[model samples]
Target: MAGILIIAHAPLATALRECIAHIYGGCPARIGALDVLPDSDPVEVVAQATAEIERLREDNGALVLTDMFGATPSNIAARLATVPQVRVLAGVNLPMLVRAVCYRTTSLDMLVEKALAGASKGIQAIGPGTPAPEYGCSPTPCAEAAADAAEQAAAGATDNVKAASGLSAGVLKPAGAT
Candidate 1:
């Protein structure tokens, strides 16, 4: 399993980890974070981040998630990328982190793909909307419609039901079915 290292502006990294723990009951092992203060020395911060990345990766490689590109955190992540077995991604979000942690058993490239997919799918411009009401429609039609919407929320969903609903397709399956 590849370790996860979150490098972001101060508090964002910690807050994201906290959010993950709150949602998942607990944060998984080998997941670490470094909150980069705006006023902090970039050189010193990079040094600290390097050590954290090394510690988290251990013998395995690491997936580095940063809050934004061109930021200090991302800059450090870029520097760390030169090191062996370290991959960096910008625009880190809660969904991305959750998916990364869940699929840590996968290969580094696969995990990156999953993370990007998760992050992109998680974003949605949700607004007030009501489920279509059909006077002659039965309950089954509504259920089927929801399932269809999930599957077709966005074209080319390879990793599963990563829709605006935020639920995985696996959740709809019966135990031992897969």
Candidate 2:
């Protein structure tokens, strides 16, 4: 099993773990985190993250997830990647973390793919005719529709919320646009 090491800005990694606990009842073994504060020492964080990764890795490889590409957490993760059998992925999110936990028993490469898929699919924008949040509407913001909306916007076209109006008519529609 590949160990999960979440390295992120202060409190984010911890909060993500807590969220997982809240949803699943308990934290799984081989999953850990390193919270990098704004004023923390970069070199020290590197050393600490490396040691933590080693501890979590145990007999298996480790999968590290950082908040963003060029931030402190990611920089430390980059350093940790020098360790053998370690993988680092940026854009740590709730969906990605949950998915990583579920698939942590797989190979590091496969875990990375699963985590990315979860993160990408987890993001969504509001659509019209979607039930109000109180009504329990499921949202699925299709990327192609969003891109098309952007193109329309750049072309000075007005967006009408009718794109997703079919939800109330038993005609399921893609999110963001028709």
Best by lDDT: 2
By summed lDDT, the worst window of 10 consecutive residues in model 2 runs over 164-173
Query: Where does the lowest 10-residue lDDT sum fall in candidate 1?
Result: 169-178
Off by over 4 Å in 2: 130-178
Q: Write the per-residue lDDT of candidate 1 for residues 92-128, one digit (tens) a residue.
A: 9987887676555445776788788778866776467
Q: What is the C-alpha lDDT of each candidate?
A: 0.71, 0.72
| Candidate 1 TM-score, true structure as reference | 0.72
Give me the displacement of residue 52 in model 2, in angstroms.
0.6
Q: Native-vs-model 2 lDDT?
A: 0.72
User: What TM-scores do the predictions have?
Assistant: 0.72, 0.71
Model 2 agreement with the true structure over 123-144: per-residue lDDT tens digits:
8775886455663653332333
